[model samples]
Target: MSDIFNTSIIFKSSIFATPVYGPTTIGNMLWFFIILVLAVIIAKIVSLNLNRFLKDRVRKNDLNLITKAAYWLIFSIGFLTALPNLHVDLSGILVAGGIVGIIIGFAAQSVVANLISGIFLIFEQPLKIGDNVLIEDTLIIVEDIRIFSTIGKTFEGIYVRIPNEKIFTTTITNYVANTARRFEYAVEIRYQDDAARAIQIIEALIEDEPFCLKKPGPSVFVDELAADGVIIKTRIWAPSEVWWDIRTTMLWKIKCALEKDGMEIPFPQRTIWVNLDDGDSTPKKTIPERNHVAEVRIHTCKPSHPALEKSHPNSITAYNGPDESDKE
Candidate 1:
């Protein structure tokens, strides 16, 4: 046991005396720490300069990425230079690291894809922080953009975390990208009401709104003639910030104005007709009864105009007279 102890003490002393590149024993370790400190300081300086240089060229979202990359690059060079001084073989370590990296790459392929997409997003600047956007049918306000994911606050006041890969591939509607937005509505009025008068009323209503833009002007026209009424279409442009407010309020205002003008918004209307004997002086069918019951046939026809009949030969016209059988 004494001999083994003596051998261990000799081995340790030999190691302590041997020079590892430069200073031996504890001195070399202290120097290594000092070199690391210097590396940190140099990395910080490089990062600061890189940030300053890219301040104008790059977007604010990419500033952090650029500085982080600069710092890591400088730090890695310093680490590699100091690594040889440690007197340890690094070939095996490098090989093992490569193998581990390959395994991780296969295991976390999606994570890597998200990271790459995040980088593209920061550079492209399709959306910035605090922008209102619609993604996957959800309207949200962007909060923070990270390397792997983006965070958003939904209109419902909930936080949503979307992977950068998904965001990059999906369609994003940026509502605030443009200064102005358009809104349209179809106002229905009775066929008896004058369409020209209705249009004039709507134009006046739109002109009165402060948010509505005048240069482009508002459009009010008869768009369609339906079975029940005429559809008056109104289209107007407004600032994006006030688009929602204007859209919600203008409709009610128009409704009130039209009603005050005695214009009626019509509902579905249908007309029916019945045939009776006028010569009998009683409400009874003229046709002969078969087996103690009168045989009667009914026909339906849609009311049409001369203009419509000229355009559509097959269109059914209004009932003109009773059928030949009833006449007989």
Candidate 2:
């Protein structure tokens, strides 16, 4: 093994040694630094030129992206170019990098997954900045599309940072992805109410609303026959931005219009029947054990106890205990 190792080292040195020109290796080192500095300066100058040239059309965010990418690219190339000066073989370094990367990958598999997911998201473009979206039913606006995560502002004015992996895997409901969206609602009316008139009233209310889209007009119909009342379904198309306003305003408008049209909104109700001949409501009278050995039974119940009855206020007796003996 030692002979094999020694022979390989000797062979490697001979192959890569090449020829050290001029003085010591210091010249190569110094030259590498000079090239590195020049690269950095050129990268910055080019980035500044782009900024000034597109000053009118470019936003601060765009400029930041341009500058950042340029800086990193320049720095990376400069570092790689300096490798030969340090007497390091590129092939060896690449192989070593591969091995190290594999080892670290086992330790950070999740991180790699997230990075790949983020990359795919940038290209998919399911949602964009300045758009309102519901991710996992949590409503938020796309504040920014970043490299590793998505930044958002919730309806409650809270800032949210969601990982790219979660965003990619979870359902993304982009409200503003399309110009027109269907808003749905159900209005319940009493059984005695006029169904046709109720539908017409809701349709008219939606049509008059300016935010509602005209192409689709508005739709209203009896969608369901519910237990307490009939459910009137209404669906209307509206611009995504004004959806919340239209939804809230339409509710009040529909209810008011129905009332004005003399249509009743059903309330929860029930029916009950009482029978007097079955002895259900009437009570039996019982006298204390007294003269003439009077035998009787009284069924008295507590205010909340349902079927339990007692012979006396504080004394509990079977519901049929004394009543059966009295009959006999």
TM-score of every prediction relative to native: 0.59, 0.60
RMSD of 2: 14.5
lDDT of 1 by residue, 210-243 (tens): 8999967889999999876899999999998888
TM-score of 2: 0.60
Q: For model 1, what is the alpha-carbon lDDT of residue 166?
A: 90
Residue 41 of model 1 has an lDDT of: 98
RMSD, each candidate, Å?
Answer: 13.1, 14.5
What TM-score would you give candidate 1 relative to the actual structure? 0.59
Scored by Cα lDDT, where does model 1 land? 0.77
Give the per-residue lDDT of model 2 (tens digit) for 268-291: 543213232455675444333322
Name the best candidate (by lDDT): 1
Count of backbone collisions in candidate 1:
0
